[model samples]
Target: MPKESYNVIGVMSGTSLDGIDLAHVVFEVSDGNWTFDIEESQTISYSDAWLQKLKIAVNFHKDELEKLNSDYTILLGETIRGFIEKHGIGNLDAVCSHGHTILHQPHNGFTLQIGNLPKIAKIAGQKVICDFRVEDVALGGQGAPLVPIGDRILFSDYDYCLNLGGFSNVSFENHGLRLAFDISPVNTVLNFYANRLGFEYDDKGKLAESGKIDHELLSSLNNLAYYRQSFPKSLGFEFVKNTVLPLIESFDVSDIDKLRTFTEHIAVQIASALPKKSGKLLATGGGAYNRFLISRMQEQLPQIKIEIPEKKILEFKEALIFALLGVLKMRNETNVLASVTGAKRDHSSGKSYEN
Candidate 1:
């Protein structure tokens, strides 16, 4: 028997503004299979100041954004250093991070993810892999829903893979090709409304469960032109701010009513993305804890059997997937999917930093 080598830190901050999730994992690749052992994981919540700053950064002047990018890189470096010290695990290989997505408007030909990689490498004293989306976007891809590559590689046993994080996105094989995209808004809008209600999120969906579903609202959401646009489409903060929020605000809807209706809408769009019942489906992301949302999705999607994996997968799946993408990039494997992201071709994405 021989000793195996494994150690890496994965960092992910999603669009829901939930804050940063850090996973200390053992990614052991051997015998043509991948084995992941998550030794430690923690989430650091964002301060009110950070959240507000991120919201405004979307509209920031170029110079201001550039400045903030440097600042953010320092911020991430500090966070990772603290995380490493607290965990007390050594023998590090690398740190893979999916930094905060600041601006994602691929149609307009730009996406900004600001966090200083050199700074992270400097502070963390580890080889770093960050900025995982730019190269694909350069090829005219949506530069999002990048986790499908991980899903296809790590959890390929499942027929479909859906993640309900700040946003709900899904990936499944169709005609021998893996396809994935953002289905619709999830915690991004839910947290927005929940913040209005003085909470970070609608816990267990109790608030939504207590209220009535507005059929009219559900109909409007279901009829949104984006739903009919076909696959490979993604939703973002701008979509929520510009389209979803405005439409929801125009109506004199109750808080619970809005929550209930929106949960249903999420369930609807998620159901639409699923393929016909074949094998089990793997569902992860923060939104999986919303018992009401999960129940609703289960009811609507009777054909697909949905299973939420262990807590580590449910909470840190995106971070873990981003880490896997980083690994693929290190190996120079095909990471981006042309069919899923509308890129000119499948390519390796992300930049590397050496300490």
Candidate 2:
């Protein structure tokens, strides 16, 4: 029989480069239903040196990337150790990590997430389950927006699960299948412009609120080919660098104007992706805190009720879900959904390493 309960640490580093999110989670299975509690959670900000390296890592050569991968694994191990010791965590069954993504081009049949090396298990002194995306992509899937499984199992009360992380993505059941796709860029683009103005983020979009929308830029963004694509699609740093940034840079607008225009674009795209029917939308991730953005989305999606959960769920939902993925992997159960990712079939995905 499968174990009834598990305690694990879920570590996540998003494209927004906000920091490393560590969540100590307890998952219990009762009568085939799953429940989770995030006992402790924290975000550890990255240093300037690490931040600079990671931002340019996608352009690194194969050997360089391998070295960085090893270094990052060590860094992740050390960080997880600190988190465990600081919280006095004990009896950990495993550490489930969504190692920081560097290159996510599923079209090319590969995606790379650093810090999943075997050395991590040794350094952290615990069993580790990670690299969850590669297998899904190997089976011909987008290999992203992996949190929908958690949404389906843990938070099934809502009709839609929308996450505004580095990128914006949404998942919901339709026609007896879970459908999901990336809607638009979020902090990945906004924070880039915000950094130019000497701020980490827009602080509830106050900067964007003060700025005017550039209609021309907005139209260009909306017309991008990615928007017209079907579901099971995703966005990555390459998309931002090659497609999004160039389009925005073509307009000689103020930084605040760019932020405002992009924020509006994000809201419109997200609203457009939803079904016309009225239902509850559960919003989470860092972007959920951007009050102005959420208000704009509310305006566009008036019929759909947008609900934001408590602070813990808002910030650490992805990490918590990654923990669930690890648990599913340990049980040899399906964690990656074929319908959501467009994989060949649903399967348990992740490599496990014992310390």
Candidate 3:
């Protein structure tokens, strides 16, 4: 008989460079339905040195990138080990990790996530399931927004699941098919501007709320070509570094105004991407805390009701989903949705190493 439950640790690092999130979770199945309990969770802030290295890793040469990948694997292993020790956690089925993304160009048929080497299982002293996106890319998919499957299974109460993470992405059902795509850049761009102002992030979007909106800059941002593209699409730091940053930097506005304008852009993009009918929209990820941004979004889509979950889900939802992804892989069940990622077919993804 198959196991009815799994205890796992999920690890993730987003493009925003906010930090690495670790969640200890237990998933159980009953009557073909799934539920989870978040046992423990923490976010370990990255050091200045590591933040710089990861930020520039996309520009690294092949050799340098290989070394960086190896070092990152070690760092991730040590981090997971520490979390386990701190919680005195034992009997984990696996440690599921979405390593930091260095390069994500699914259109070019490649996406690289560091810290997924097989040795991580040995270092962390547990079985591991990771490198979840590579296979989907190999099958001609965007290799992103992998959380929708979890949304479908564990959070079906809502009509939409909007994740305001490093990048904003949404998942929902349309005509019996699960559809999802990246809405726009969220914290990935907001945090960059905030860092320039000597703050890690715009607390409650207070700085943005105080600044004036640059309508011209906002218009240009709204007209970007990516917004017009259809579903099964995604964005990465490359798009932000090459396209978004350059466009935003070309303006002479103050950083505060830039923040204000960009926050409006995010709100507009999110509203435009969502269906305009009355429904429940479950918003999660770090951006949910941005009161100003949420207010703008709510104003734009008056019919949609946005629900902010508890602190654990708001912060560690991605990590929690990755834990579920690991459990599915252990059971050889479909974890990545072909409809969401535009893959060749629905399939079980990720590489598993039993230590």
Candidate 4:
């Protein structure tokens, strides 16, 4: 498709395992200026059973996972069709999906996102674009943090753009190149603790306020090996289930103290990722709802300004970015950042399917 002729739906399910976000967007390129319209958007929360299945997706055996992959694609197709009907979207150029990230162990040179292709086309009766990370990872990159390209193109005004979803990643252009990576796990770790107290998440960080910070735990978590790793890296659900949970368990502490300490750890790491200059830092995702986490970030470093946009923007920014990614892929433009993921070179990485 030509740059001037593109309209897409970008689907995204983050590592948070929160839900699927779908956006019907119209992208246009005129006189080399890229623009977009978010026509409609909605989130489809996972059912208890689906949540449980996806929670353990990182641990599924190969054959079982392969089956679930196709099944999940069918499930997504149904959801997307319902979204289209609900919003009265028509003449969609394509549905661009960032299939759920199941495993991201780039060191072992492997990553997986399981949403079958042909099954999706069969079910949706529409062209689809998915499986966006493997190509970059195969080319010696962290098959993750692929959002910076969107940030660079669509949200170029911000000095720093930070996403506080399942993981914390900041994007910014430096030295004539865009730099981004997984800074730390945000909602993934916080939501885990909050769930123990019969809450889905620490809404506005109220639970965290009731909890006391364990300085020792805070120090220990801040010193994790992953934090010391260089850029072009990412985190996985398995890493959290295997590495993070065990490390927290080793302390044998209460959930409150765990939340308190972890919030501080997040603050330290996030503050460190800020550029050594003064500018506005846009914060988004579910973590923005965690007031306690935001407070810790402010207390740790008052130099950087953490600006949260409108509610819809905070919730659907990733979904919106994915929509833009689809626009780029459709135009055969580079959506992956070489400076961020250390890919052999910048490139557009996705496989598109036609119905």
Residue 336 displacement in candidate 3 (angstroms): 0.5
Stretches of candidate 3 exceeding 4 Å from the true structure: none
lDDT of 2 at 236: 88
lDDT of each: 0.85, 0.94, 0.94, 0.84
TM-score of each candidate structure, all chains considered together: 0.95, 0.99, 0.99, 0.97
What overall lDDT, based on C-alpha atoms, would model 1 receive against the true structure? 0.85
Give one digit per residue, the lDDT tens place, for model 2 in 224-301. Answer: 999999888988899999999999999999999999999999999998898754799999999999999999999998
Runs off by more than 4 Å, candidate 1: 1-4
Clashing residue pairs in candidate 4, if any?
none
Compute the lDDT of residue 43 as modeled in candidate 3: 99
lDDT of 4: 0.84
As for lDDT, the candidate ahead, 3 or 4, is 3
- lDDT tens per residue, model 3, 195-284: 999998999999999999999999999999999998889998999999999999999999999999999999999989987557999999
lDDT for model 2 comes to: 0.94
Worst 10 residues of 2 by lDDT: 270-279
TM-score of 1: 0.95
